[model samples]
Target: MGGSNTSHSNLKNAVLAFLVPLPSILFYLTFLYHYQDDDPNLLSPVWKWCYNHPILLANIFFFFNVNVLFWLIGLIQSSHWMIDPYWTVIPVLLVHYYANHPLAVENKYNVWRSRIVTCLTWVWSIRLSHNYFRRENWQWGVREDWRFTDMKHQYGKCWWWVSFFAVYLSQQVFLMGICMPMYVIHLENKQLDILDFVGIAICLSGIAIAYFADTQLHDFVSRNKKLKELGKPVVPNLDKGLWQYSRHPNYFGEQLWWWGLVILAWNLGYGWTFVGSLINSLCLAYVTVLVEKRMLKQDYRAEAYQLYQKTTSVWIPWFRSPLIGKSKNT
Candidate 1:
């Protein structure tokens, strides 16, 4: 009857909404590179690898497909599995291999391409993972990132689902797109040139800038926590190192690195890669604004933060004078 038709229509809409962005994510994943297993992706006229080597294949679950429904469920359960983020560094390199470089055979790995990205991604992944693993309560449920909680709090309840779709799913899409360059390297027509070399240098510089900025911030925060634990004197403001130049040097560097990805794609002629960087840049800019407002709430040392603000730039690095302007608005 009418009820049955309505149910069917709702089901169709749900399916469509769920899958709207899935193709783009996977397209960037496959259009640039082929994800392979130790046992080749294809079957030699017989059966399958999943049946024989299920555990090995399962170990690569982090790189496997996910859906928005899982994302919703994760949020409802207060679980990280909904987003299921992993060291996408490897996935980036893997996809870049397919995009920029052509394959000689069906199942062979390109030595030069694989080696460069694998090393870089591994180094970055190890550095980040090691830090999180070292935290005291690194258990699965308890080890959630506070950044996610903060976002949930900021958005509030009524708009939660919208926030999940816009924030988490959208971020995953960018993560997939921005990484296409790494895999797109396989699809590149031209051989290595000065532009390529320069692009590589910029990529490295972006890496260094992001790493140091995050490291310095983490060190600054960790020092405060240590002081709190030891009952020692603590500095409320992080006006040292990268903090002296900008209120959000880490966010700035993160945005810079993503833009560097755009530059690499431009050099490689995969302009679509810029789409992800564009989103990341805007989001980071928004985060910087939010951080400034959040810091303003701490009236305990209002003058100290004001002093830091007065002498520091908000988004860009520049010499701040005591007079001219304290923040981005000024």
Candidate 2:
């Protein structure tokens, strides 16, 4: 019984790590196929504008280049993206697929559905891509993804390959896979239902929360950059805004968005889609709880963050005061 139990445990652990990043598989296969040949065309006015803003163009190029790098990593190390799984969404072009396929017109409304999703995704991607490249000293090689760095160091030798690919690369793949709700449903050639509206609303709300939290954090942190120069309280880490509710609200909202995608997918007739998102969230939540409980708890021990943690809910805004609270600035 003991031996059998040990075997079962090993099997469970193996499967958990393996399937965690499953979506990247589909992304790598589907995403690269579009590059088989390029349509040669002169630049449009918009293209010319994009070229003029070289930095913005470089940002977009960097992200797409990152996409290529991710696939290359998969090809080389058989690894997956653990931190940001949505990186896989690039290849599937799930929305683009449904928007133009001959069958799209069979359900014209669904075509619009795909367009909406594709639009939102581009907006988010463009924002993130530009934001990343905005950094002056951006370098590509051997960058540390906080989570993966810990995992790599933890496994050291014994399960290095498994730790690298299964835990890391699979996350990227799964991100692409789970992002399929909007694209896949459009492909199904069906009308959008009330569920679609709910999903859309939830996704949009998530975007707003994520953007707000990120912007607020950046502003708050940067606002005090001068103070840090003067030697003071910024790195003390203010918890005035959404940071009040949870130590890692940005990460929480991101987790929620993927789960929102999962929910939307499930509503679109894809059963068990929530399972994929749930697992992703659970993994992230564990990481967040582990890290934040130690770090944030250590830093913001009693005053603001702990007060917020005690009072405010983490992800779901069940009951709370408005985020528009008094800040050090105001």
Candidate 3:
């Protein structure tokens, strides 16, 4: 009965999570569809102003639609769980939004590039959304990322306010920055070249690598759970498959995808967009340190994880080094 009740509650929460932000999404899409091409005479003063400055308009929409609205919801729920799913969905939204903006150049080459990138973005979003749902056991709003929960504890009473900046505002910057390439993609109509193909290759490779790595990691965790249930010794760390080469193959793949997009923009003469992927990579480096520290703190996994760290590359896949001093059995 308790299990059934818990499942029912989770399903309700999932439905609410899906429904809550939907109106904002629909409104944004409607606005874009209605104003795809700016008409000075037909538009309201405010709409005309926004239509002139699409990027600024996007930021404004993000501020209210995402930052403020999500913050309020988080405050009410006491969990910033919604942001995880949004991370996957936002890039897709930004790409299409930019493609449909009046500023977008509608040439044959530009249309081709746009369609390719949009399809790739959809593929990436679907894979990530799948992983998120699997990780959360299809439940929503029931839990937040461990990092956010830790921050809440760290800040105590101040978390209510601190979360606005730390969670929502920070995400706004990162998401917009990372999606800048999509904005640039629509701005120019350069002919498709070999570099475009190269970008596609890199992006697809990243998606494939991330998919496999995440699958391996998920299986590792599931197997460990079964081992514990059956009173057997669980594996201390994942050191097989792609995990044999990099300490965080999934993150490595994610970086590849972002950098791949940067390459696309760079080929279009907007190389400065690399800043977004660079910032994301640096942030991931910090996260890598935190994750390692967490692993080391665990008594069951600490020793083996340390050994694994000594042998494996941190982000890039490479040949494993010789064991530092002695084998685990020694």
Model 3: how far residue 35 lies from native, Å: 3.4
Steric overlap count per candidate: 18, 12, 0
lDDT of 3 at 327: 91
**Tens-digit lDDT track of model 3 for 1-330:** 999988887887777767766765686666666676545558777767756888887887788878888889889878888888989988998898898876789999999999999999999999999888888777676689899999999999999999999998888888899899999999887999999999999999999999999999999999999999999988889998999999999999999998899999999999999998888899999999999999999999998898898889999999988774469541
TM-score versus the correct structure, for each prediction: 0.66, 0.62, 0.95
Model 1, C-alpha of 51: deviation from truth (Å): 21
Each model's lDDT: 0.55, 0.54, 0.88
| Per-residue lDDT of candidate 2, residues 1-330 (tens digit) | 986876674465345434533453444333334323422134455544442343343234334434444445543543433224335334234455444433344457765676667776666565454433332122222133456656666876744455546554565455544555644554466677887778777767666777777777777767777887987765455455776665567776666566666665676678666665766777777776777565555653445455455556766545455543544422
**TM-score, prediction 2:** 0.62
- After superposing candidate 1, which stretches have Cα over 4 Å from the reference? 1-64, 69-76, 81-114, 131-139, 143-147, 150-164, 230-233, 322-330
Per-residue error for 84 in candidate 2, Å, reads 5.3
Give candidate 3's whole-model lDDT: 0.88
